[model samples]
Target: MLNIVLYEPEIPANTGNIGRTCVATNTRLHLIEPLGFRLDEKSLKRAGMDYWKDLNVQTYIDYNDFLERNPGAKIYMATTKAQKVYTEVEYEPDCYIMFGKESAGIPEEILVHHKDTCVRIPMMGEIRSLNLGNSVAVVLYEALRQNEFAGMNLEGHLHELNWE
Candidate 1:
């Protein structure tokens, strides 16, 4: 399973939606401390619907705490400052993909220390960044695709109907 790390995520809806994605993709979610909103917020529950409970989620007091628990784990930080594109690296199973908060991205110290593991999505438009949920989906799906969609269902749910 892949690990999705949200470092101080600000928005409830984004986290909730990401939780849903994790549950659907059989991925693990790790949240760093000082969250912007409460985990039980209505917005979060609404966005996640009933799938939030199924998500394999964990929380850390801080970056150091996370590091202490998962020592030697391959962590790829998603940041705009990275020179390498997300797809440039070969993603391995159980690798941790981390995204920062909406207002501020990952800390400079962490980025500098793990410079080789930092990556970014290519943005062609004038927009500064993509939505948190969208960004996660983009990178996570690419990783899943690279792994040939392991542990995921490929067939359409309504295939028996033959709608086409």
Candidate 2:
């Protein structure tokens, strides 16, 4: 399964939607702290997030905390400054794909160390970037697609309904 890492995400709804995506893909969601919102039951209810409980989520105190816990993780950083396209890389099934904050993106301090692993989603010249949630889906789905959508159902069935 792929792991999606959000470094200091600032939006609650984005996280909630990412949590839902994690659930749907059977992926893990890792959140580094200085988070913008709480994860308490009341907060989840306020966000109308029902499947959060089903999400395989983890929280880290900071970047070092996350590195200490998941040592040797095959991490790929997503950023606009990257030369490599997301699809060009061969993602391991257990690789960790990280996205930076909505405003600044992963600090150059961190990305500097992982230059070879940095990737970008191609976009028009006028656009600054895609939505955080959409960006995650784009990169993540590429990883998942590379993995042949493993352990996921490829087909959908219609519910039973008849009209005269």
Candidate 3:
């Protein structure tokens, strides 16, 4: 299973949408402390729809706490400072794909320490970054695609059709 780590997310809707994505992809969600909005916010619930309850979410006191818990885990930090494109890295199963907050992004210390594992989404425009939820979807889907979408339903459609 892949892990999607949100470092001090500032927006409820983004986290909520990311939660839905995690649930859909069968990945785990790890949230760092100092969240900007409450988890029970209406905007979040609305964005996540009914899948919020099914999301596998874990909260950490801080980045160090997260590192302590998942010792030796392969982590890929998504940042604009990284030189490597996100798709260039070969994602391994159980690898953690971490994203920073809406405003500041991942801490400099962590990025510096794990510089080799840092990756970024290439953008042609003048924008510095993409939406948090969209970025998660983009990277997570790429990882899943590389892994052959192991646990996902690849068949025609999710629901069976009865055309009589």
Error of 1 at 161 (Å): 6.3
* TM-score, predicted candidate 3 vs. hidden true structure: 0.94
Lowest lDDT block of 10, candidate 3: 151-160
- Which model scores highest in TM-score? 1
Show how many residue pairs clash in every candidate, following the order shown. 0, 0, 0
User: What does candidate 1's lDDT look like per residue over 3-36, in tens digits?
Assistant: 9999999999999999999999999999998999
Candidate 3, which segments miss by more than 4 Å at Cα? 157-164
For model 2, the superposed segments whose C-alpha errors exceed 4 Å read 41-48, 159-164
Q: Residue 90 in candidate 3 has what lDDT?
A: 99
Give one digit per residue, the lDDT tens place, for model 2 in 23-99: 88999999999888887736543443778878999999999999999999999999998989999999999999999
Q: Report lDDT (CA) for all predictions.
A: 0.93, 0.91, 0.95
- TM-score on alpha carbons, each prediction: 0.94, 0.93, 0.94
State residue 39's C-alpha deviation in candidate 2, in Å: 1.4
Better of 2 and 3 by lDDT: 3
Best by lDDT: 3
The pairs that clash in candidate 1 are none
Q: Pairing residues by index, what is the TM-score of model 1? A: 0.94
